[model samples]
Target chain A: MDDPLMLARVQFALTAGTHFLFVALTLGLATLVALTQTRATLSGSAVAERMTRFWGQLYVINYAVGIVTGLVMEFQFGLNWSGMSRVVGEVIGAPLAMETVVAFFVESTFLGLWIFGWDRLNRWVHLGLIWVVAATAYFSAYFILVANGFLQRPVGFTMVDGQARLTDLGALLTNPTALLAFGHVVFGGLLTAGFFMAAVSGYHLFRRTAEADLFRRSMRTGLVAVVVSVMPVAAFGGMQYAYIQPTKHPGAQESAAQVAQFEARFGPGDYTPPGLATAGEVLMEVAWSLMFFLAFAMLVKLPFGRWLERGRVFHVLMMAALPLPYVAMISGWVFREVGRQPWMVYGVLKTEDALSDVGAGAVAVSFTVFTVLFAALVVVNVWLLARFARRGPEAVRLGAPGAPEPERPALTPTF
Target chain B: MQTLALVVLAVLTAGYLVLAGADIGMGMLLPVLGRDGRERRLVIAAFAPFFLANEVWLVAVAGVVAGAFPGLEHALLSGLFPVFVALVAGWVVRDAGLWLRGRVDAAAWRAVCDGAIVAGSWALALSWGAVLGTVLVGGSRVEDGVNAGTVLGLPLALVFAAHGAGFARWRLASGLAERARRVPGRYWVSGAALAALPVAAGARLPWSQVVSSPEALAVTAVMCVLMVPLLAAAQALVWWTFRGRAESPGYL
Candidate 1:
């Protein structure tokens, strides 16, 4: 508990985990929102447009915290893990930098345009902005995974004067670990979005809200999203376990030689990850199995959309199932990150060696601050999402034509 | 490549200061610019559409630093760990406040979020000033010793506040703009403050000693070359789209 390394690790886990919670939804919903908007533009359906605004508002709210949490994640690397930067930063830095340039920069700008450009710009242009935002969002995820992939299975870099230098850009970008993980993450995002939409729409249907038609259509969309994405999510997770895990972790088939090579190069240490890695993997698998069964059940209802909408039991089940994808995604993330234990950059840099020269006290303070803040954010984010979800599309103000002004006081206060 | 990286870093930093600085400043004066909850919402709406785009400039700066000058990222961020922590905390709080303020239609919720915005904005402005001051006075290493540059943090924060006021005067409706006018200084001061931050910070760092390997730098620079123009174009679109004065409260 007193060790700075342990504290730093916990802090990273909590903060990064919280950030991923928002990001999973952001990536998925951004795509959904873009698709909905595209349909609205092409068909000129007011229902689709309202759907876009409704979902888009939630996306923005989630994204707001995601961006800030991401900033903290970036800062954590330099603040608590400077040693990794001092060593292998050159290799991973390129993809990370490209991410900011290509994704963060473009995504934010386009989203801003998309948000404020409604009714002001040409309809086609406004629609184009969302697609751009969605594309850039994926690009952002890809670049980040590339960097994380480097840590999982370092390649295309050579050690020189105690620092890893980039030798092959192509090899670094196409690291199979990154590509596979990318698929898993993207599918996981879609699954999360599917459940979120279904849960929200299900709640409305259970209560027989005035917008039954709207909720029904969204319910269908949500179910379709789940049916399409869940299989891929499971498949990708299986692929990673089958293909990537054995190569990275010791005690797995064909991993003895790599373990031996590591021991010889870095001198004797525990080398193997702790038991928690297996625990996380098991938890993830269990969650996935549960989601798979639930998804299948939902698939059965898809053909009978009318019965499904009125089924209070199904709505309750959906609301209950809302947390499944979140749980699975986090557990899967835990497995991936924790499974690579002892090494911050597997085989290249030990976790202990990558810590910054900060005191235990400072790390503790930061750990406490970040945890509390993130927890508060998560609470508030969920509360807001739930509140808005309950209110339904009637409350959506995003891109509303001539939004009413806030009530001004009789006398404005002087500056 | 090194020069290009440095140039990109400079441009991004300056862009953040000039663009995002206005919103941060506006956040600092959120209460003053708008009296009641309704007024405050308006003040926030004035900058809402542009804030996300503006903040990304800082993200870009951090990216450039980490990617092209890992040594600098390691040295600067860790050397001034406490300051960075405060800055990040402020950033998180401020953003959370802005994003969540209007989501719920409760007076208390908005009030609390507003308080977070003001406090977080001030914290961001002051901590950024501290970072700059620490570098200026302490050179490459940020020591605990108080110096002239350290003392300068407060005044720099005020500069940010004034920059926000100037921005408010320009973007707000006529009634709110008049209220903002009392603070004095308009776009010129804002521009000067924006241009000054990067130059001051740039002068303090030993750029030659902090650059990464040539290959990494070259790759990063090429990326910047490809993306910066697109960033510029998209940013111009945002500014153009919202060119008119903020008339109604935007989605927060």
Candidate 2:
């Protein structure tokens, strides 16, 4: 704890993990919200519109914190891990920059339009903005994964003058390490959204809210989303373990030669990952197994809508089960990231070497500040989400009619 | 490629200063601009829609620095670690306040959030000016202690507040606009402050020395070239859509 390197590492883990919690839900809910809005636009269904507004409100609330945390995540690299930038930045930086341009820039702009465009723009154009937002949200995640994948697998780069440089864009983008994880993450997001929707709807039904029909449709959508997405999440996750891990990980079956090469090149060191990596893997697998069974139960209940709605026990179970996907997803992330331990860029840049030249005190201060702030923000976020969720669709002001626009006075020529 | 990268970086930095600066400034002056809770909510609604988009320019600037000028990114960020820390903390608090202020319908909750907005905004504005001051005096290394430019940070923060007041003057309606108008040099102050950021940055950093490989630079530069125009169009659309004054409080 006194060591700056350890402190920095812990800080990164905590901050990034918290940020991912928001991102997972944001990515999933963005898609769900866009789809709901699309249904409303095409069919002109009032229920669908209300659903869009409701879900959209939740999405926006989550996204609000997500954006701020993301800003922290961006600055963190330069703040604590400058050596990573100085060494391999030529390789990974390209994708990160592309992410900023292709995803965040576009995503924010379109999202603003979508938020404020309510009754202002053409209905189709407004709908298109949301789809753009969702697509770009995935793109943002993809590019980030591309950069991270390079760190995990060290592909499409060649060492020049002791610094990594991009040798092939295609190789970087298509690295199975990145692509497979991207798939896993995307489906993981959907599953999370499915569970979140189901849980929120379940809470409403459990309470015997007046908006029973609205929640019933939402509940069905959530359950069906889970059924469709859960298997793919498992499949992609399985492929990553079966295929990518063996080739890239130090202790895995196929990477013995690579491990030997690393040992010879870097001299004596504990090149193997920590025990926490294995624990993360085990935890993730356990959570996923439980979620799979729960998903199966949901699928079974799908055929009998009225019975499912009336089963207060099931609703309570769903509300209880809400944390499963979160646990699975986070643990899975920990498994993947922590498993790459001791190497900031696997086999290329050692973790300690990647740290910025900061003192333990400074790093500790930052660590405490960020961790506390994130925790507070998360608490506030969940509280607000619960409050809004309980209030249901009627409380949504996302697309609600506003007071009349105030007349603009003539601009005083002040320049 | 390096020049193109620098141009992209310059553009993004200036854009953030001009756009996000206003909102941060407005946040800083929330109490002065709006007298009561309802009035403060109105004050926030004026800039809420544009805040997300405005802030992304700073994100883009960070991206450009990390991608194009990797060495500088490492040096500048780690060197001024404390400043960036404060800036980021303020950013988080201010944004949270803005997002959460209207969620709950309690006077105390809104007040707490409003206080967060004020304190966070001030922190952000001051830290940003300090960043410029530190960089201007070549305090790009931790060893470089306080200098003249560091002191200049105070006045620079004031400039941002003035810039924000200018924005409020433009975007607000009736008494709020009148309140903002009491600040001297509305549009002129805002324009000068916006123009000053890039100029100061340009004067301090040696752009040519810090660039990445041409291949890497070219890739990012190309993406920026392709997307910037689209970004501009969308940004214009947002400005156009919300061109009118704050008629009522928005979905804060």
Candidate 3:
């Protein structure tokens, strides 16, 4: 516990884990918000509009706090793992930098516009901004996975003067590992959102809240999102698992062969990902199975809306299942990251070698500070979201569509 | 043409520093400039729409360094880990404060968030300036496996305050704008003097040696020379364009 490397690992894991909770929800919910808004725009239904505004408030709340975690994550690289940046900055930095310029800019800028444009812009234009937000969110995830993919399976790089440099951008983008991880994450994001939407909607529905039409529509949308996302999520997770199994858990001869080959080139040290068979992987599988079962049960009850609607017990069960996706996602990430143990860049660089030389006390202080801050943020964020979620769509001050119009709209037309 | 990426990087960095500097400056001056909670909310509302997007330039700057000049990023970022960690922590608190202020109704909560905003702003401003000062002075050295530099951190922070005041002068109105206008004059002299310490100390470190490419160094030198004047002109233009008090109170 006193070891700097161990402390650094704990700090990274805690911060990243907490950050991911928000990200999974943000990525999932942003899409649903966009889609719900689109449905409102096309149908001009009041319930759909209410659903959009209600869910959108939750999305904005999560996004506001979630965005800062990413900045913290970036800081950790320089502070905790400066060695990795020094050695592989050229290769990994490109994708990261591109993500900021291309995806982060587009997502943040359009999200601002989308938020403020609610009362200002034309219906279609407002709708377009949200779609842009959704698209760019996925785009940002793509670049991040590209960076992570390089760690999983280094590609499109050449060792130049003791530093790894990008030799081919095309190869980097098309890396199979990156593609698989991207698919898994994107679908997982949707599942996270779907479950969240369902749980919130179920609570309101069970209690017979003021906005029954709103909750009912939201429940259906959430259920549809869950059913649609689960299949792809499972498939992608399986593909990624299949891809990693051989390398992660090599045959006896394969392990010896890899060690022999790596020893000649990289000098010495064990080549396999430590703890080939880990509990995290087993837990991930179990969580995935539970998610599949839950989703299937919900789907089976989809036809008998009348019967299920009356079943308060089923509604309560749905509420309880809300945390299942989060469990699956965390376990999956733990398995993937921990499975790559000892190596920060697979066979290229060892994790121990990539640690900065800062003292244990400094790292310990930072770890403690970050843990406290992240925990506080999570609590505050949840409280705020719950307050608003309970308050219903009317609390959203963006103004409902049917409300009396102001004498003059302040926003100027941009297009 | 060959040094175009480097030039782009410099321009992006300058843009982030100027634009984000103003936004952060407002946060730094929150306690003094804002008399009450209403005034603080009013102040934040003015820049709320665009401030988050303004951070893109920072990401772009990092991108350029990591993508185009990995060696420099490694040298600079890893060298200034303490300042960066402080900056990130400041950002987290600042963002939380800004985002949470309107969400809760409790006066105590609002007050705590306001305090966080001020503290976060100070940390960010000081750290950002220290990073730049460290670079210009060439006094950065690795000591005890940590980045330590001889750059007087306060000067850079003062410079940011001046920059932020200039922004406030343009974007703000009434007594606040007038107060903001007085800030640069009060601080710029001292900041300039403090900044000179770095130049004087690093007088022997040739710009050509610090930057490997002659063309890139020339471009950088030109940008550095043009920067202050350009910022001044832009600030003047903005002030002229937005001379009167804001028409609407805040974001609708």
Per-residue accuracy of model 2 over B1-252 as CA lDDT, tens digit each? 777777778788888888888899899889988877777877888989899889888888888887788888877777778888999999999988988887877788888999999999999989888888877776334235345666667788888889888888879866678889887647565767676776675667766666788888888898898888888887888899888888577877
Residue-level lDDT for A100 in candidate 2? 91
lDDT by candidate, in order shown? 0.85, 0.85, 0.71
- What does chain B score (TM) in every candidate? 0.96, 0.95, 0.71
The C-alpha interface RMSD of every prediction is 2.1, 4.6, 8.5
Instruction: Tell me the spans in candidate 1 whose CA falls farther than 4 Å from its real position.
Output: A242-258, A401-415, B142-148
lDDT of 2 by residue, A204-262 (tens): 99999998988998999899889998899989988876545442355666667656777
Q: List the residue pairs that clash in candidate 2.
A: none
What's the C-alpha lDDT at position A174 in model 2? 94
Query: TM-score (chain B) for model 1?
Result: 0.96
lDDT of 2 at A198: 95
Give the TM-score of candidate 3 (chain A).
Answer: 0.90
Model 3 vs truth, CA RMSD: 6.5
**Against the hidden reference, what TM-scores do the models get?**
0.96, 0.95, 0.85
Ten-residue region with minimum lDDT total, candidate 3 chain B? B207-216
Complex DockQ per candidate: 0.66, 0.49, 0.28
